[model samples]
Target chain A: MQKIVPNISVDCVIFGFDFKQLNVLLVERKLQDEKTGETLIDDWTLTGYHIFEDEDFDTAAARILKGLSGLDNIYLEQFYAFGKVSRVDSPKDNIWLKHQHEGFSSRIVTVGYYSLIDNSTVTLQLQERNVKWFSITDLPELGFDHQEILNKALEKLRSKLRSEPIGFELLPEKFTLSQLQKLYEAILGTTYDRRNFRKKVLQMKYIIPLNEKQKAVKHKPAQLFIFSRDVYERTKRERFDFSI
Target chain B: MQKIVPNISVDCVIFGFDFKQLNVLLVERKLQDEKTGETLIDDWTLTGYHIFEDEDFDTAAARILKGLSGLDNIYLEQFYAFGKVSRVDSPKDNIWLKHQHEGFSSRIVTVGYYSLIDNSTVTLQLQERNVKWFSITDLPELGFDHQEILNKALEKLRSKLRSEPIGFELLPEKFTLSQLQKLYEAILGTTYDRRNFRKKVLQMKYIIPLNEKQKAVKHKPAQLFIFSRDVYERTKRERFDFSI
Candidate 1:
């Protein structure tokens, strides 16, 4: 008797900020069929992979990140598990479908994980076809239900931003209050009173003022601030509400 | 070229309270060997299933609960994803291996979900095997990493208990302050100051004192209280710190 097993995989939508817009890492589908000579070169999606029989889910996520982006020790969080049976389009008509076996179907259950990385530090090799970063707001139609996955990740990110100091991960090590406010505004997709935002952020005491200021902006250079890791660690143990 | 596809599955651990202790639903695993005519009887595990290729994970979870427990619309939440290779111990050296094909390997990734059900309303049937409720504290050695999954679910339960009005799910529709307090103590594993606990709960203003009292208690007949759903829904939308 053949034992039936469920296949598991992990997908990650890495988000970063370029001081103006939110961007996500995406890769073009590389697998193609030679017999029919068809390709899905334009269908881009998040970096994902199958969970090997022996690997743990978190380990599989880290391994996928390492394999695709060549980055390690990045903070990765499990967001949602996508288990809609037909999330992937049918392979029968898909050029990529010819690459798979006949009896097997595209029944993928993927756990979505999101990571925040500094885009400047990332060295894009384009090793896996057309791997690139696209503005999240202007993303093209994704291959699978990746657009939905990305939206869910953004919601998680917004909720996380309220309680945790995760926004720092999307910005540079040293940044200005305006930059921080802009990042929050972009993520929340709402306008905030600048004075109130600064006041609230200052009250949290998670950010420390640096002596340096932003140098290249056309307007008045804003004072730079760095996230106080020690302060964040200490305050995290205490219950503080940052709902607003 | 062979195309690789992933299979998806959902596993649920339903929890209930029996006034004295916390319990979890388990199903017996029946193993029979064709070669030696041997059988391993009464092996118990969580209720699980392979999600059809086109079903949503949440939908599959609801279906599994309805199929196994004949219950729906219960308080369910996703806890963790288990993707460890070799999670299922092979019985290759056992008598059952003789009936199975060689070089056959099964890799399964199971997402763990949990539901809080009223113990009194749980109607059990020996659908698959011997279904029984075991005290969570004294659960039998479960298959694979189910024990770990249960622990994570309990942690999530505890966290949700502090933030939401989930204790009502574990208790009767009408309950006393002491019963409510005991439920919290059981879930949190900590003894609370009786006066302080009552005061804090009262301050939340989401519990309504009913026009009745417990009749058969050993001590004073405590005033019955019911969670005010309207108040809870309203308060949940606002930011309230439940750190203490």
Candidate 2:
């Protein structure tokens, strides 16, 4: 009797911020058409994989992240699953499917996870040939419903930012309130009254104002601030509301 | 060259309320020990599978739900991905490793989604033997890391309940304030201040008061109310702060 096998896998769309715009990492596909034995034009996509039998889903995502980006110990959170029947346009067009003797089309049920990382920490590895970063706003036409995945990930990231101190991950260790507000505005896709935003931030008492000031801005320099990691940890662990 | 197969699949844990406690649907695993060639005694688990090449992930989940419980059109949402190394204990005892030809030890990654369904809608399919509902608080040891997955799903559900109007799915069409409170308390795993909770619910203006009163309760009969689906949809779509 044939033993049952599970066909499942995890994919990660690593999103990074450079204080200006949102960006995502993508890898170019090298698959060819099976029937015509013709190499298909290269198309960029997210780094992904088939879940190894011995590995956990998270481990697979981490491995892909490390393998493609050469970065580890970064925060990765699963956001959504793409299971639309027509997710992949044609099953027989890919090189991966051509190798299977069973002649079955590829039905990929991918769980998309987004990671927030400071762009400076990212160093390309073997992915240099196949991977590149595209601004979330100026994305090239993608192959799959990756655009939808990115949108959902952005929504989750915004929700996370509202409730947690995850925005700190997108910024330098020390920054100004102006920079902080800019980051929030970028993520929220809307502007907030600077005075109100600052007042709200100060009331939270989670961002400690530093004695230093930013040196390079053209206007009056703003005071620097660092996230109160201790307070954030305590409040987050206790489930305190951080909504603004 | 051997063809690489892209397999798709879905796994679901159906949660139901049993009047006094929350419960989950589970089934038994039929696989035997690989190395010892001995059947493992009484290992129960969640319903899952590999997706057909032509099917979507949501369709696969729906199919699994129907196949296992004979329920259709239930409210199911994709939750977190369970990906950790050793999520499935590998290194099948030495005996199973010896029969390498079987490939039973190949890695499988599963995407876990969950649903909240009224217990009355459950119609078990005779195809499954030993199918039963276990109280979420009193679950037996499950296969793999399913217990952990179930816990994460519950946490997600709780968080979702606070942000979204998912309570409508769990409660009957017409429910008393006390019944609504109990449902919230059960999912949140906390004791809510009844007066304060009621105050907040009423302030939302999304609960339509009815003339009918709940019968047979020990306290004074509570007024019945139905959720305003239109208001809920408008509020949710407008992205108003729904934090309670």
Candidate 3:
């Protein structure tokens, strides 16, 4: 028997960028009436599970993410904790949750953990649970206050992106500056002056320009640049800010 | 019959500054032998409690702070959550905790909340709890992973002090640039070039200079300046970064 903390859970909000739009990984859950064989609830929710008795919150979040993506050492962060009393009180979620957990009748305080991933980097292996990535702007009606959780995670991501180098987590190892700008625009939901944005970002010494360009494209291949973590680590005194 | 969540708690690390040093608010707990009436254990810990089932994490933190300080609308933020399996398993803390609660036998995951206050602003009224301010550098042995929690909160405060104007939370409404510099030095545990520090901070338009001067001082009194949140709010687009 798997012992778990019945009143606490860790919800992992995996955000991925496919070089176009920002998306979040969610799982589809469908509950059917046992006696009448009718669909009672069919909705999407964040990937989460009750934390094990022996696991800390971070460990629980990592375990859940690793189980879904089969990847290790992803950039995971615990952003917020959602503990609204009526968060899980919806009749549909209450009925659906009964089919999932053995004893989950009480309120659950879920620690919200999020990560940014380049969609091509990881091989998602939870198709059996119907895990799919939904564009952040066109999200379905999520269950159990997960929409609020995702919004909070996006807000945090936006704030961190302004002062941190976390936006590279959503890009390939070698990316063009246009790709970087697009990723920022998608997450922040705003457009930036191309010249101004590039001027400010290129000043950061850590964005090392590689003597390389795109392989194949319809337009002119822009120069490629790699975010040098080594350079950043060496000169960590410099604050990474691109509020332009 | 005060019902609470037995396995979840909120710990508040209240940080205050008195223009000389940074301090943390702590409460003392003592355990005594039942028959002999001899003291078994005595130690300091953060002000916290097992959360009520009806309360959210932020609400619980604010309630605990208000109950202790009798102050409303102080700056409070949820920093991190400490959920180690052995966090509350210390034999000494376990013995002392038994007297405080009816059933706290299981592992408790505590969400760490922190706040900054000007020592002169609030009237602390928890004399009976042996609540006192201790300098961060010279702290007593804290109980049950609280030392680790305090260390983490200090680290967060240091990082925030670098990029945000949260340092103003520790000063009086009208303060000199020298006082602001001293507050930053005390929190970041370093000294700065006086000329450079003032030059950088003076450029921030939000720090408005008033036609006022300090009074009742032995030496030459400096000019007084107030942190204009109105100006900050009006031109909030400018990122507040004081890495100098």
Clashes of each: 9, 12, 0
All candidates in order of TM-score, best leading = 3, 2, 1
Residue runs of model 3 more than 4 Å from their true location after superposition? A32-39, A123-127, A190-205, A209-213, A238-244, B32-40, B98-101, B121-127, B190-205, B238-244
lDDT-best of 1 and 3: 3
Interface RMSD of 3: 5.6
Of 2 and 3, the candidate ahead on TM-score is 3
**DockQ per candidate, 2 decimals:** 0.26, 0.26, 0.33
TM-scores for all predictions? 0.74, 0.80, 0.89
Q: List the residue pairs that clash in candidate 3.
A: none
Distance (Å) between predicted and true CA of A116, model 1?
A: 1.4
TM-score of 2: 0.80
Q: Can you write out model 3's per-residue Cα lDDT over B1-244, one digit (the tens) per residue?
A: 5588888899999999888799999998877789999988889999998898899888899989999888878898888888788888788987877777668847889999898888967757565678889999899988889999999899777766655678888888999988988888788788778898777767778999999999998999999999877777776573522221
Q: Judging by DockQ against the true structure, name the best candidate.
A: 3
Better of 1 and 2 by lDDT: 1
DockQ of candidate 1 compared with the true complex: 0.26
lDDT, candidate 3, residue A228? Answer: 85
Native-to-model Cα distance after best TM-score fit, residue B148 in candidate 1, in Å = 1.7
True contacts kept of each: 0.39, 0.35, 0.25
Give the whole-model CA lDDT for all candidates, comma-separated: 0.72, 0.69, 0.84
Over B1-244, each residue of candidate 2 has an lDDT whose tens digit, in order, gives: 3222333336798888755577788886555666897775456677776655566667778988888767678888888765554565634323332443433333445578888887745546437467788888788878766788888888887767766787767667887777777777777777778898788788776788999998887988889999887876666442423110
